[model samples]
Target: MSKENKHITVFEHESLRTDRGEQRLTNGQLEALQLFYGENGVPYYSLIHHGVRFNEYVGVIQVGKTVIEVLPKADKSNDADRWRNVLINMLHAVGIFDIHAPSNSNLRLRSNSILDLYFELFIKEVEYLLHRGLVKKYRKTEGNRTALKGSIQFAKHISQNLVHQERFYVRHTTYDKEHDIHAILYKALKLLSYINTNVQLNSRLGALLLDFPELYDIKITEALFDKIALDRKTEPYRNALEIAKLILLNYHPDVNRGTNNVLALMFDMNVLWEQFVYVSLRRHKANATSIAAQNTKNFWKPLSGYRSKMKPDIVLNKDTEDCVVLDTKWKNLNGYNPSPEDLRQMFVYMKYYGAKKVALVYPGSENRNQSGQYYDHSSQDSKHLSNEECSVISIGVEKDVKAWQKIIHENISNWCQLQEIV
Candidate 1:
C-alpha cells in the first residue's frame, strides 16, 4: 500500500505541521488535548518496518468529514506504554471492551496491545455508579426553568432565526459608517445583558455553586443576574451558562497560575487523580475510603501517646478483613525510602486495624533499594517480618493505573486467600 494509505489517518481540530523539528507536549498539555478532544475518540497506531496499523483507538476529533488520530508524544520507546494507555482510555470511553471482567478469561488483552488487560477490572466501578444512581443523562430537562418558555431550547431557537438576524447585522449595517456608535453600544449592552441573565438562570451552575461553596465567585454571581435582566437574545444567555458550568466543574483553587510549587503540583495531581484514578477505582467496586490523620487519631491512641496524626492518602477495603493501606506522597523516594519512623507508624496501623497489607506509594522517579521488610520496635523482642509478611509494598504512583490496580488487587487477594487458608 502507499505510505499515505498504509498509515492510519488522525484528525485534529487545528493544524499540526511545524518547521521547527518535533513538538513535545508536557503531561498537562497532553491532558488538555485529551479533554478537549473527548477522551474516547483519539486513535493510536503503530509503525513497524514502514508498515503502519491502527494499534488502538485513543480519541477522535470529528470536524465535518474528518477524524483525527491522536497519541501522546512518543520521544522514546519507554513512552510507548504510557501513550498506549492514553489510547486504551480513549477506547474505553467510546464503549469498546468491558473494563471489568473476571481474571480467568480471554478478556485479558496483552498490555502491549494498546488494549488494557485490566479493562474488565474497571467495569465493577461503572456498575457501582449506575447502581448508586450517581450517573445521569447529560441533558435530561429542557429550558432554564419552566417559566423561561423557550430560553432553555436556545440553541435550537437560534437555528430557526439565523436568516432574520443575518439580514439585520450583515446587510442593513453600513460598511463604512463610523458614526453608528449608538448602534454598536446598544448591541454590546444587549449582549452583556443576555450573558448575565442566562448564567443566573442556569440551574446546573447554581446547583454546582451550592454544592461546592469554594467555587462561588461574587463577580460571576452578579454578572449572571445582570445578563438575565438585560439580554433579549437567547443565544448569548445560553452560551454564557454553558461557559459558567464548565468553569464551576473544572476550576481548581489551589493552582498558582505561574510557579510549579509543591502545593500547586499536589493540587493538580489530586485533581487529575480524582477525575481519572479515583473515579475509575470507585467504579470498579474498589472502596476508596478516606482516613485522614485526624480521622485516624482515635484508632491510634492505644498504641502511642504521640500526638502527631498522619493521614495516609487512601485506604482500599474489600471488607474489614481484606484491606490495603496506601499513602500517596508527591515526592520521589530518594534512596532514603521510608524512614524507621515511617515504618513504625505504618506498623502500628497494620497491627491496630488488622490491616493485612500496607503501601507507601510515591511518585515514580528515582529507584530506591527496598528490602521489603521493616522492624517493629513495639514488639517485645523487636520482631522483623518480610515486607510481604504483613504485606507492605512501596509502589511508584507514576506506573500505569492498570499496574497500580494489579498491585493493590494482588495484595488484597493474597490477604483474603490467606484468611481462607487459615
Candidate 2:
C-alpha cells in the first residue's frame, strides 16, 4: 500500500490488491477494515488473510484517508471506469441520487471515486440551500431572562432564583435556525471536511463550513428523521437533508481506538440489481396490464407456528391472469446453465402464483435467452410431459442506462407474447 494513491477501485468479490499481486491496503487500513466487519456491524466484506475481500455489496468505503470503491461486475469486462459509470447510472435509475446536478460531466470528470461524487453532490446541494437562504422554524427554548415573556417555571424560579427576584426562569418559543435539519447538514459538512480526500473540493467545503452556522449537536437517529415534517418552507432543504441522512447514518467513528473511523456507503448488489431491473421494466410497461414487484404469497405453514411467505421479484399480469413471474439474479451466466436451486425456485413460483410462464433473469455481455420446459415427474407415461415452461433471460448491459432498459423491456415483452403498446 502506498500513501500517494489514496483512491482505489475494485469490483465485488475482489481482493484488495492490484493486478501485479501487490497489496493495496496498509496494516492500519486492514485493521480498520477488520474492525468495521467485526461483530455488531453489517458484514459487507470478509477478512482475508492478506486483506479484506469485498462480497456482493458494492459502493464506497473510506477508512482513514484511503477510499475503497467496490463496484458490481456482471459482465466479463474488467474496465473499472465502465463499471463505475454503470454503478452511478444504476444508482440514478434507482433514485438514490438525483441526476439534476448542475454539471454531470464536470462531476464525473473530477470525481475520482464514488465517495468523491457523493461529497460533490452534498456540497452542491448545501451551496444551493445557502444561496437560497437557510430556513428557520419555531423551537422551544428555556433559559433565565431578566424580563418575563413566556410561561415561567415557578418551581425552578423559586428554588434556583430565590435570591435573584428580578430574573425569571421561563420556557419561551423562538423562531430560529437551531433545528434538526440544520444540525444534520452541519454534521454532514463537518464529516465531509474530515473524510474528504478530493483536493479540489476542500476549498468549497471550507467555504461551506465558514458560511454555515454551527448549531447545537444532537444525537442522530433514524427516528429523528422520521419525525421531520417538511412543508412548503422546508421543501427546498429536502435534497440536502436526504444526503445528510445518508452520510450521518453510514458513518461509524471508532470511539475506542480512535483510528478507524469507517464511513461505509455500501449497497447489496443483489437488491440493487433486482430494483434496477424492476424499475426498468416498470418504466416501459409495453402491453402488460400490470407489473408488481416482490409480490408475496403464503407458501407454507405449520400447524401452530407462523406461516412462511414466498416473494417473487417481478410478476407480470395480462388483464386478470398471471402471465410471467421473473426472478432477477445479479450474475453473469457465462455460458453456464442456471443452478438446480434456481430452476426449482422458479418452478415453485410458477406453481404458487399460477403463472403461465416463469423466467430467471440475469445480466451479461450479450443477450442469451434460453427457453426450457419442465418434465412431469408424476406422469406414468414417459411421453406425457407437462407443458410448464421456464426461460433463462440474460439482458445485455449497455453503456447507456436507457438503452439497457429498453432492451430489457423489449425482450421481456417479446418473450411474454405481448406487443408493445406504442
Candidate closest to the true structure, highest lDDT:
2
lDDT per residue, candidate 1, 239-293, as tens digits? 2233233323322222433211110000122223223333333434423342222
The sequence of per-residue lDDT tens digits that candidate 2 reaches over residues 45-91 is 88768677788999999887778889899877889889888888898
lDDT of the structure predicted as candidate 2: 0.83
Looking at model 1, residue 377 earns an lDDT score of: 53
- The 0-to-1 C-alpha lDDT of every candidate, in the order given, reads 0.35, 0.83
Q: Candidate 1 at residue 342, lDDT?
A: 66
What TM-score do all the candidates reach, one by one? 0.33, 0.92
In candidate 1, which residue ranges exceed 4 Å CA deviation? Answer: 1-218, 221-267, 270-310, 316-321, 330-336, 339-344, 362-371, 379-422
| lDDT score of residue 302 within candidate 1 | 45
Give me the overall lDDT of model 1: 0.35
